[model samples]
Structure formats: structure tokens, C-alpha cells
Target: MLRIFYHTKYEFVRWWRVAAGLTLAFLAAGLISFAVTGGVNYSIEFTGGTLMQLQFKTPPDVAEVRSALDAAGIQGAEIQQFGANTDYTVRARDEKQVEAQDAGAEGISKQIASALDAKFGAGAVTVVRTEAVGPKVGAELRTGAAMAMLIASFFTLIYLAIRFDWRFGLAAVLSTTHDILITLAFIKIFHIEVSLTVVAAILTLVGYSANDTIIIFDRVRENLKKPHKGETLSHILDRSINETLPRSIMTHATTFSATLALLLLAGEVIRPFAWVMAFGVVMATFSSIYVAGPLLLWIEGRWPRLDDAATARAVRAGEAAAAAPRGADRVSAR
Candidate 1:
């Protein structure tokens, strides 16, 4: 098996300041974009609308399709060509059509299909799929998605607190929060449509980032138990990260490959999820080393663990005492 970064002593936490500045700048840019662009581009699932996938026997003019929908009073519908020239997706999520969906699930979709059929001929167009969401249901779904993320974060904090010290828990939680913010920024800057699948990707990112932090922290905990008399916490953190560098590299590389495949090959329906996941892999690795490590050091400085030194000394004394008896026994036997 190939080995890389074996026994390396590289100091990863030394660049935390650079990482912090970049993170802040990116987030600020995302905020400015949000203010300028009027917030996230929510999908029909969370914004209430009718979505129709239509297939035609021959290619149709987008302007003609728009004219037909307008002629039938299905105004403000968004039309985009899908995979092939003969396939298209129609989104009618205007307030009027959203209100009309409350009357019947198929009301807006039927109107769209009828309008297209009338313009192109009855048998030329095929309604492949239709999704209708009512305004009230969309609002509920949006609320539910938000709540799901909040609840996941809350439980993750609780779990980390139970598994590690309060300082480590707080640092890990904050790191996970940073990952989410960065991801949202990426989505906003690129205008990735917010959908349930994208929400799932964010949730997955939270777990992935937290897990990486936990791995490094767990190593730090193990190292702390050993005799390292004069090492500062930052040095210990650096050692821990260096020790785990190979594993981190392998894990991230494999996961990123899979996500990249999805980003390139997955259909449009899942493309947003893939985009988020692909970006998340890199962000998670960065936060694990830069964000979580530096936050932990700062936290330790703010609330110094007074017992840690005493505990280390005691461990060293105990080991020395244990060694004395063994050495004496060997001497006596010789």
C-alpha cells in the first residue's frame, strides 16, 4: 500500500489567520450578493408552482412557446430547454398561478399543456411529468426544511458535548456552522436553486465536517494522555493534524471523486445536490484543519484548563514510578 505524509510534522494551524480572512471576505460577498439578488432562488417545491416536463416530436421555438402560454393567460411562465432540443421544462410559479393551484392540483399544469397543444398541434406535444404545489404547502415545506436543519444542528451539538470536552464541542459545532455558511454562500453566488435535495446535501455536509473535526480532536485527546511535557496546545493540535494527514487525504480524495462524478454525470434534477456536495468536501477539509484547530486553541486560551498541567505531571510521575520498579526488578534478577 502507498504511504504519504508519513511521520510529517507540518504545522497546519499556522495559516489560520489567512483562512479566517478569506472566510470572512467570502461570506461578506455572499451577503452583498444576497442583498442585491433578493435572497435564495427557491425551487417550486418551496415556492409553490407548477412544473411541467414536455417532449415534442420536433424542436419548437422558445419564443413561440412563450407566446402560446401568454395567449392562454398562463403568464410569467419560465421556459428552458432541457436535455435535448425536443425536451423542455416549463415553470409557472407566478403568484396568480400559485393561487390557482389551490383550486386543483392540475389546474395550472392543464392550462400550460392545453396552451402548448393548441399552438403546436394536439399530437405533437407530450406531457412527460407535472408537479403542482400549493402556496400554503410550499410555505409549510420551507418551514419544515429550516426546522430540519436547526434540529440537526442542535442534536449534533449535544452529541459532541457528550463525546468531548465543552471547548472541543463548541469549536466543532462552530466549525460545522462555518461549513454551512460557506456552502450557502457558494449556492447563492452560483444561484443554485434551493430544493429538498440541496437541503439534504447541506445536512450531509454538516455531518461530514463534524466527523472530520472529531477525528482530529480524538487524536489530540489520545496525544494528551501521553507524556509531552512542554508542548503547547497549538503544537499538540498541529501534531495531531499531521499524524492524521494521510487518512484525511485518502478519505477526502475518494469522496470528492464520487461527488465530482455526480456533478458531471448526474442529471439536472440532482446537479444542485452534487454541486453542494463537491464544494462541501473541500470546505470540510479546510475547516477541520484551519477553523476547528484555531478555534480550539483560542477557546483553550480564553478558558484555560487549569487541571491539564497537573494531570500531565501526574501521568508523567506515575509512568516514572512504574518504570523504577521494573528496572529494579531487572537489576536484582541480573
Candidate 2:
């Protein structure tokens, strides 16, 4: 018989500086983008806009539709095929167009209908749907989304605190936030419009990143209970992550594969959503291992008392459990 063994001693915490520097760079770029762009470019859903879904008897050319809208003097109008060649969605903010300042939501709808009717004939075009959001209503929805995310983070912290400890929850939350910041930075860099769909993606990443962090933290807790000889906190964290590395890699790989497929084949309608999700999964995975674990270890190093008490308790519990089996064996022998 032959015995084989592998030694694992990679200290992820040691590279904390590299991770921190990269995060700082990302944030700085996002801030600079904000300064340059005036803010995140919000979609019509965030800024008040008139949205019209149209269906024509004949398949309509997107360029012609855009040209029709442009000729109508509807500046900043965005036109795209919704699901089929004959179906299209158009959105535009209120702007001076041919002295129609009094064209309210209904008037805007009529103007769009008139423009398309001229191109495709009176009875050939159908107004499938129309949605108009006022600036106040859009602002409220945006604010509500921000509040929902904040409340979610608060509850996540409480849940983690009860499950593990305050330090674990704190670290996990911070890592999730980092993932969001990086994702947002990328969104800004690419000039991707921040719509409700994008906000949903950010929230999805928050939950996902937290789950990954919890898995790693749960493993760390178990490892702490069974102290390895000559293992420092950093070593234990490294070991915990190493043990979960296989699972982490497999989980993220499968998600990435799916998301990448969606990005390539899901069509323009969903490309932005898929792209954000794809970017988010990668960031969440990296933050769980590199950012969350290192931050926890750094906290322990700065305030030893915080972890020392928990460590001592775990050691005592482990020793008592070990003695229990011995005591039972002696009794049975007697």
C-alpha cells in the first residue's frame, strides 16, 4: 500500500494589501466616472419618460423606426425591437419637439401613433401598450429601491450575527458591499444605463455574495472548534477556505457558464441584465474568499480580545467532548 499526502499552506490573508489596493482603484474610477458623467446614467424607468410598445402588420426596420421618431423631432428617443421584428418599444424623455410642450403623456402617445401611422399607414400599426412615468413617481420608485437594499443589508447582518457572530456578519456585509461597489463601477465605466433591471441585479448579487460568505464562515467556525496544533487564526482561515475551495469553484463556474451563455444568446433585450449578473457572480465569489476572510482576520489581529474569548470557549468545549468518550470507555470497562 502507498500513502500520498498534500500540504496546503497558502495564506490568502497575506495578499490583503493587493485586494485592498484593487478595491480602492475600482472605487476611485467609479467616483471619477460620477464626476465626469454627472451621475449614473439612469434609464427611462428612473427618469420620467413616455414608453410606447407598437406592433405593425409588417415587420418594421429598427433604423426606419428610429428615423421616423427622429424626423418627428422626438430627441433622445430610444427605439428597439421588443420581442419580434414587428414589435417595437420606444422611450424618450420630455424635450422641446416642434412646439408641443403641452403634449402630456396622452398627447405624447398620440404623437407617436401619428408618426408611425404615417410611415406604415393608418390601420397597419397597433398601439400595444403605453406607459408614462412622471418625474416624482420615478424618483419615488428609485428611492424605494435604495431603501429596500438598505433594509435587506440590515436584516442580513442580524441573521448572520445570530447564526455565527457579530464579526462574521460584519465581515460578510462589508464583502457584499464591496462586490456591489465593484459591479457599479463597472456599470459606470461601460456607461450602462441603470434601470430597474440593473437594480434587481445588484440586489441579487448582495444575497449571493452573502450566501458565499456564510458558507466560508460556517466552515471557519467548525475548524475553530477543532483547533489544529500550531495553527494561527490566519492559518485556520486559509485552511477553511482551502477546504471550501472546491465547492466555491464549482458553484461559481456553473453560474458563470450559464450567465455567459445568456449574455451571448439572450438577445439585446436581456444582454445588459445578463452581463450585470455575469459580472456580479465573479465579484461575489472573489469577495467571499479574498475580501471577507482577510477582513475578518484583520479584525481579529487588531482586537485580539474579540476572537480570543470565542477561541477559548471553542477549545474548552472541544476538550470536554474528547474527555467524555474516555470517561464513557472507563465506565464500560468497569
Candidate 3:
């Protein structure tokens, strides 16, 4: 394959400066979002509630379902149309039950199906997905999610340390967390309903951001082994980033375009997921260059010895050859 890695090192250096500025700007925006909006707003699923999905033979009227719930005094109920044209999803908390049993439980779903069947016929609707979240279960889920994220971040730090230098790993972990926090900030700002899907989306973005970091790390390692291994870490990283930058941009551009399409056409339900992924991809690119590279410089560049070992080796070797008398003398000298 054609190796363009050495060709575009300087370009990535310039690009990194621009991307870093944009990243800082986005980080500020995300921070403001966090300040204004409380942490992510959990959905009924995560907050303790009932979810009933009914697939009908025809396109069902959404207003009728909400009206039905309203007539029964089901306050703050959320009804949505799911995948396909026939599915209807209804969710509500079991906070204040007027009935003896939890009305938002299985019995309520059965009643809903029966009511719809009375008008649309018995075989018109099928209950495809249903779940009942007790208050305790929701609390447990929330706790488990928090713990998982903590553990994942810790393990990521350890893995990054073992894979490359501790500086790269530490920076990668920080950048990953930054991506997650910013994504959550956006979610909170827009009041995205946080469900299991949102959790999955966050985890997915972590993996994605990590993948991008690892790729750059790999390129850096490869360049460190080449003849220019004596190059400055910043220059080496810039080179690696430039080599991979094209591919990274292409991949993210394709995904971003697809996400934009989704954001435009997809319903409210898919909007949160699409936005999170799109935001993460853009942020990950910037961090892979500036955040990660600057970290290496800050940590390793603090000392005079470690800072120039690679460059010194290459420069000395070149000067020795250039000053040698002749081809035969250089060969004989070696």
C-alpha cells in the first residue's frame, strides 16, 4: 500500500491547532449546558415506570391514547410511536395510583388493548413489548449504571497505560470522559429522556472514542520505530495524526452525514441517540490530536533529557554521515 503517513505531518499540526480551538469552544458550551440544566433527565424506564408497546394492524391515532390515559387520571403520561407504522408506546410512573393495584402495570396494558380492540376489533393490536419498573428497581439500575461507568473509566486508564505510555493512556481516559460529560450536558440541555438506550449510547461512544485514540497511538508507535524515530514527540504525533487524519475525517464525515440525515428525518425518539453519537465523533477527533498530544508534551517535556533523546540521535547520525570524507571512507569508517 502507498504510505502517505510521512507526507502530511505538517498539515495535521496546523489542523490540530484549529480543532483544539473548536473543541475548547464546544467544551464551554457543554459546561454551560450542565450549569443550566441538571444532570441527565432519566426517562420513565430508568426513573421507575411502566412501558407498554402495542402494535396495531393499522396506524393508530396517538392523541386517542393520551386522551384515554388522561381520562383515567394518568398524569404526566408519555405516549410515542415506535418502529414501523403500527407500534404505539405508552409510559407512566406508578407514583399515585387511584386504583387498589398499580394501574400502570400489566392490568392497565390489558385494559388498553381491550379498549382499542373494542373499536378496532380484537385482532387489531398485539402487545409487543411491556415492562414494569418498580421504584426500587429503577433506583438499583441508576446505581449500577453509575458504578459501571466508574469501573470502565478506571479499567480504561489501566489499559491505556499498559498499551502505550502512561501519558497517552491518562490523556485518552480524560478525553473519553470529557466526551461523555459533554454528551450528557447536551442531553440535559435538551432534556433528552434518559432510558437504557441513552446508557447504551454513552457506552458506545466511549468505545468509539477509545478506538480513535488507539488508532492514533498505534500510528505514533509505528513512527517512533521508523528512521525519523528521533523526531520530536509533538512532530511525531502530528505526523501520525496527519497520516490517519484523512481516513478519520472520511469515516466520521460519512457517519456525520448519515446522522444528519437521521436528525432531519428520524422522529423524536431517535434524535437523542443520533445527536450523542454525532457529537462524540466530532469531539473524539479533536482530542486524539490536541488533548492527547499536549498531554505527552506536558508530562515528558518537563525534563531536558527525555525531551530530545529521539531527535538528538537522528541529528547526530545525519551530521556524522554528512561530514564523512567519501563513500569509501564512510564505509570504511563504519
Which candidate number would show the highest lDDT if scored against the true structure? 1
* Superior candidate under lDDT, 1 versus 2: 1
lDDT of 3 by residue, 154-200 (tens): 78778888887665677688778777876776677667778776787
Runs in model 2 lying further than 4 Å from the true structure: 1-9, 52-89, 95-106, 119-130, 306-334
Clashing pairs in 2: none
Residue 115 of model 2 has an lDDT of 86
- Give lDDT tens digits, candidate 2, residues 96-202: 43123234657667878888888778998899878776676678788988898898888888888899767677889889889988998999988887878888888
Query: Which stretches of candidate 1 lie above 4 Å from their native place?
Result: 307-334
Rank candidates by lDDT, best first.
1, 2, 3
Highest-scoring model, TM-score? 1
- As for lDDT, the candidate ahead, 2 or 3, is 2
Better of 1 and 3 by TM-score: 1
User: Residue-wise lDDT of candidate 1 within 1-334, one digit each (tens)?
Assistant: 4375888989777788889999999999899999999889998999999999999999999999999999999888989888889999999988989998889989888888888888999989999899999999999999999999999999999999999989889999999999999999999999999999999999999899999999999998888778777676777888999999989999999999999999889877789999999999999999999999888776655445544565444434543124211111000000
lDDT of 2: 0.75
Candidate 1 lDDT (Cα, whole model)? 0.86
Cα lDDT, all candidates: 0.86, 0.75, 0.66
Which ranges in model 3 have alpha carbons more than 4 Å from their true place? Answer: 1-6, 14-21, 31-37, 54-67, 81-88, 97-104, 111-128, 225-231, 246-275, 302-334
